[model samples]
Target: MTALMTAELAWYATGRFYRANDGSLADYGYFLHLPFADAPLFDGKPSETSAHFTFAATPFKADGIDNGALSLGLDPVGQFSLYLQRRPGATFADPASFAQGECIATFRRTSLVVGTTVAASLTSASGAILGTNVFSARLIASNPFEFAGKLYDLAQTVGMGITQFGTAATTPVAPPPPGYDLVLPFTGSAIALGRAG
Candidate 1:
């Protein structure tokens, strides 16, 4: 388990994200889906063997940077939209902010019955083109295990990733391109069933 957690792991998460503008939620939210889980088949086979995101290394590194920013190494080209949040902020923050990144993962033991709590903060500094962004997550280990002074849990991890952008001026922008800044917020849970090669 130490090797798995310290090395690489694949996460299978089922969550939803909603787009809001001016604090008003959308009439309907959208569900998160694997990139090619339901896409056109090629050569009578699926595009990817697994839909889960593959981490090159653990996110709980001493520095908390992970093998690569979140999973930037997984898809450096950004073709899969693995980290679309970086798209608009390319100028403001490093594309691989998750690596040696501001995000921090920690584990603390509570009790055998209650389990341990795993949490991390997702954040980035101001970039040349974008302002700072913030997000966080917490996971409880219903059935906990300890390793190297750290607790490990394979239960459902729930958290939220939210960030707002655009002019904060109450007045509307010129006369086009919507009247307010864009707010992209998503909340959901992910489960780490096992590691991925």
Candidate 2:
């Protein structure tokens, strides 16, 4: 799929649960959001009018936490889903842009574990693959979540790394909010589009 060039904030992460770090339940996964260039979301965030993917995750260890937008504010023990939203309404079941007839897309991961594949598909108003992102996720958690992307390639949006939400940044079982991190340290090729996310 095409990259959101104007969306300056790029999020990075690395996740692993249930696994003990040196006999402790401390997680090495982290969530960090940083400013990036060359991507656009049409109407960027921090603005009233915005449209982009809502990155979220759900745990296999839980019993159905939340579905779409609800999961963004729920506990960190849920599966991950990317919901397309356009602000104004910018809400669950009814994103603001849904009424304006904006493009809609959905991204989901199979297992909410340390490593897995995240598949994303962009469709037209009638549901067609006429547009998209090349983001493919890596199935392993590592220190310093690496965001490998090639800016020279317009079809490169596939990045690898663990992405934790609303929870401990480095510790899996830790608390939330204070440790929210989306690590997208620009390596120039941090967003590899045209692949899988």
Q: Which has the greatest lDDT?
A: 2
In TM-score terms, which candidate is top? 2
Off by over 4 Å in 2: 1-37, 42-51, 56-79, 83-88, 92-155, 159-197
1-197: candidate 1 lDDT, tens digit per residue: 23223212223222111112333211111113322222221222221222122111121211123333231101011001122121122110111221221112222211111101112111221121211211122222134333335443333221211111111111221221242233222223222323223
lDDT computed for candidate 1: 0.21
Q: What tens digits encode model 2's per-residue C-alpha lDDT throughout 56-105? A: 33322221233332221111223233333334333222222222432221
lDDT of 2 at 48: 19
TM-score of model 1 relative to the true fold?
A: 0.19
| Candidate 2 backbone clash number | 54
Per-model TM-score on C-alpha atoms: 0.19, 0.27
Flag regions of model 1 displaced more than 4 Å.
Answer: 1-3, 6-128, 131-136, 140-197
